[model samples]
Target: MRKRIVRYLLALLGIGAIGAAVFLFMFIRPLPVEVARPAEAVPVQVFGLGTVEAHILSKIGFEVGAALVELNADHGDRVSQGDVLARLHNGEQQARVARAKAGVVNGEAAVKMAQAAVGKARAVLAQKKLTNERKQALLSRQTVSVESAEESQMEVDVAAAELAVAASDVDVAKAALEDARAQYQLETVLLDHHVLKAPYNAIVVERHKELGSVLAPGEALFTLVAPETVWALAYVDEARAGDIRVGQPAEVRLRSLPRQMFEGHVTRIAIESDRVSEERRVYIACDHCPDRFHLGEQAEVFIRTAALDKALLVPETAVEGFDGTKGVVWTVEDGDLRRREVTFGNRTLDSRLEITGDLPDGAQVVTTLHPGLREGRAAKVTEEAAP
Candidate 1:
């Protein structure tokens, strides 16, 4: 009986060993997989966060001071050169002009009167000369006493003095007329100042004063902006600014309008960066501006500093770590996984990468996440179907 029990225990041990061997064979080894090839991708260098902007902007102000009696413009109003924008109360100015005109008329009448007086003075002088001649003749002929002739000559002298005074009065009156005319012309000009007109074609962006509101000189009445003259001011990093130059092609996208892409060119670059922000100011001129754009709108600019074509590319996901630092990739060669060290260039917007190394174009790369993936290891690179 003891011998039979030993035989049964020996048979059970043999069966257990066979079952463990079968389990190891079925589950311990890795399953064979089909390796995927790297895709043929067109390399593209793209930039984002750009903006659209105006070429120029400015604030318009008034030169004269007065109450705003009328406003012909408001925000978003289009104006042309010499268009009346506003007006001031002109009652006082008009009254002063009327008074000045009346003074001119009075002066003109005074000049006429003085001219008549001068005519009378000339006649009196002629009569006195004739009388003086007669007096001299009488004295020479001894027809009258010498004292009587002397008295007649003295009367002639008095008449000549009176005529000289009248002539001087006429000259004074003429000068007064000229002064009055000048005053009238000056008043007329001031009276015209009541109306304010635009100096150029522009769009009003702001209205600082309302009707019946008093405004001081040099105060802003309405702010006008020339949409055609608008430009974009961008703040670029100081490190990347060295590659930027005037006249380089650039792309801009406004924060407010993201769907639209506006082309532009670099017009200027600041020589110095901000001391605190360490950002350089870049000015860009838009290729074409819309019919209107608001001033001071924030924008992002992309300056195409460099370009490359027909370069070998890979999926951005193949590059390891942030910004491809410590960059590593699992490339499939002969159906086996091999780690590759790659040097990356500018990244494209579509998650494609520009890579430089011995990696061949259209080479297979392992993109699926797997455990224990290393050099000379078996891996299945599942092809990510393209959209």
Candidate 2:
């Protein structure tokens, strides 16, 4: 009787355990899951990679070869318009100018000597005329021979020729003086050319030569960029080029200064795509660019091509697929988890997605999936943070 009673108790305990397991499986509630709802907001953004560039990039080079004597500017120096940048050796040019000036002086002296010779010739010609007259009188009275009068007349002609030669010398001396003066002017210009000045308000991007270095003609002495003409050359995909247009609003962010966002507008869009990259280039004129950005720095640009007011929006996380593919979202219907298909439009500036499918207005959709969330499963809805 004891053995039979123990067997009955063991059997009853096993049945009770099975019944408890069944009861727990049938009645126990699942963990509540957090959910989100799609809201309406405006979308505004076009993404592209950009590089910092200067609108006015210029190379500073010399027209004449010379040894660099002094360098007044260095790389990264901010200079004003007309500021002196460098100087080549001016001593030789100055010497040339001095020589030219001496030539001018000598020319002037020669001109004076030519004039004096002319005067002396004129006086001699006057004396010869007087002598010729006297000789003529003597010849007429047969007091002097005809040869003597003829010799006197020849002396006058000789003096007259000498005077003509002197006059020609004066003209030649005048021309020499003019030539000397022109040479002096040219040498002076070359001397001035030795001093390089800033052509405009710019920053020195590069210095090609140091002091005492010899530079050749047409060699770049420095590279400069206009201070206020910095721009961004953004490479945008050709597929999205149609949405971009000149004068569109844009925001630029540099990797160096991640905290700052520069406001700008689309200044230009390339008419043709790049042959190699097949990307369209866009130019952005930053309204307020920081001083730190250098040429060729990588940047991210977001162009605002179009905007819609009070558009229906959802979190980007809520978008399960893109490009009209299959998209799924969880919606709470009658307190039960329900999976629904959604169609989306362009992503907004705030990263909110635009939904286009048949979702009930003001219905809550699951932005983040929680553990144990399934169709027909009991779920609790909660608001997700706005991005």
Candidate 3:
């Protein structure tokens, strides 16, 4: 009785397996797929990942070293051109400037004294010339001795030498005045350096030093971002970058503002692509950027390269072997799958490829391929449910 029971159970399991096989074969015999249609006025877009950057982002510092004394601007502060941002210990610098001014005043007085000396020397030289002429006349008339006339000539020579010395002294004094003035200008410039000022309208992003902190030349005191120079730096795939051009319209979506969309335009395109990533760098300027922006923020950009009035549309999943501009797709004809070569046009944001070639309207395309599905294999067309 036990042997009979085991044989009965084995026979029932065999019958169930056969029925399951038949059910599966009937339901999954042919590949079922959806159809595609030609579309019109589809906007072609190229996608890229990018960063929010400032065209004039800078790490500003002093050219000369000093100790921090006062900070007029802090992080997030908006400053205008020539606005004081911070100050270094300027007491010493001020003292040097005052000393230079005093030197200039002293130099001016010296110049005046030299001018008076020159005038005195000229008057004395004229007097000596008159005396020498009178003595020579007296000698010719036999009224003066020869030795007296010779002595008069020597006195004239001595007077001329004194005049020359006085003129040289005037020139030397003038030069000293110029030197003092130059020193004054230099000292004033050095004093100005002690005060850190903004070069343009910008927003401060960082503050590195505090009061009494000693800073070195070229050490960054603050980081600034020019509000007018904010832009997006995007890296586009080399394959799709062929159509990208400057002045084209684009859309930007920043990571910080996820739900908001911004308008922009392409400003520049890098000719050289990244060798490792095979991406071209592109710069886009915002049309109406945010009042405030964070540097190096991640972004997504879509550049409108072209617009097509009419194009044959196919789901991106239905196409394979795409090399940016060209790809292949599987089309159905008379209940059999056939390989069709297609040239791709502008891709839509909805993952639809614009077919450029002459493809039939309302043709069935295979979106999901199975291992059993091959070229010339019979397929059943099924309509895709509308989203």
Candidate 4:
């Protein structure tokens, strides 16, 4: 009976050991995996975070200080160049202009009077010359008394002096008139300063001051931005910004309008990079943006630099010891797993690196990592769809 019980226990232990071995064998077996394969028509894109901004923005105000009297434009109002945007309480300036105008009128009259005085002086001088000639002729003939001729000659001399003095007075009056006209022009220019005009065609972004607010010289009253100057300012990482160039096609996704995608192109690239952020500034012009745009709205941009006919791609996380230029990747050759250090290029917007070179002949690069992946292990490879 003891021998029979021991045999039964020993048989049960052997069966348990066999079951454990089978489970371990199944757990450790190499599983099938999807390897990266060259896909037809793969697009390389670079991503950037950006904001809606205008290339030409301005804050305009009055040139002279006064109380705000009239406001013709408000926020979101579109104005043309030379349009009157606002006005200051310029009653004093107007009065000065009016006084200057009256002074100008007076000056015109004074100038005419001076011209008339000159004419009168010329007539007097001519008459005096005739009288002096007649007196000298009488003296030569000895027909008139000596004292009478001398008195007539002295009177002619006195009239000539009076004419010269009148001419001098006319010159002084004309000079004063010119000064008055100059003063009038100065006053007129000062009065015009009370009115503010738009420097260019733009949409009013904000109204800084309300009516009745006293504004100082050069104080901002309206923040204006040209509609045509609107563009997206994207800050791209320097690592991914190398391929970006002007005129490349791009797509924009605004935070406020997440469901919509606006098409655009690379308009400009800043010559100097942002020192602190280590980013390159790239500007994009939206082709089909909405009529209304909020400045500083967050945005995401994807620029298509190149389109590849066939590209082998792998996720960035699958790479090991990637020093930006080259990295180690697992490759499958002859139904076995192997590791290779490969050179990469063109990082896609989806965080995938393109396998450009450095692969063994007949070896397929792995796109996904797995715990069972080991050197010399057999692999059943499956191709994944291009993303």
Q: Number of the top candidate by lDDT? A: 4
- Identify the superior model by TM-score, candidate 2 or candidate 4: 4
Show model 3 residue runs off by greater than 4 Å: 1-33, 324-327, 332-337, 349-351, 358-387
Give the higher-lDDT candidate: 1 or 4: 4
Backbone clashes in model 2, listed as residue pairs:
none
Worst 10 residues of 2 by lDDT: 30-39
What is the C-alpha lDDT profile of model 1 across 1-387, one tens digit per residue? Answer: 999999999999999999888765544434233333333434332342323444434555555577888889998988998999989888898899999999999999998998898889889878888987987898899988899888888888888888888889889998999999999999988877778888788888889889999877677788777767677888876644666778888777777787886887888877877899777888888887555576677777777765654554556665676355336776777766677776776555466566666565555655444555656655544444341
Candidate models: Cα lDDT each: 0.71, 0.81, 0.85, 0.88
lDDT of 3 at 159: 86
- Candidate with top TM-score is 3
Worst 10 residues of 1 by lDDT: 43-52
lDDT of 2 by residue, 153-229 (tens): 99989989988998898899899889988998998888888888999998899998898899897889999999788
How do all models score by TM-score? Answer: 0.58, 0.60, 0.81, 0.77
Model 1: how far is 331 from its true place, Å?
A: 23
> Against the true structure, candidate 4 has what lDDT?
0.88
What alpha-carbon RMSD in Å does predicted model 4 have with respect to the real structure?
5.3
Tell me the tens digit of each residue's lDDT in model 3 across 1-387. 999999999999999888888766754467776666556677888898989988898999987799998889888999999999888888888999999999999999999998898899889889988999999999999999999999999988988998898889989999999999999999999988888999889899999888889999889999998888899999998877888999999999999899988999999898788999999999999997876688899999999998888766777777889887777788887888887777877777688787777555555666655565677766788885231
Q: How accurate locally is residue 323 in candidate 3, as Cα lDDT from 0 to 100?
A: 81
Global CA lDDT of candidate 2, please? 0.81
The best-first sequence of candidates by lDDT reads 4, 3, 2, 1
Off by over 4 Å in 4: 1-31, 103-180, 382-386
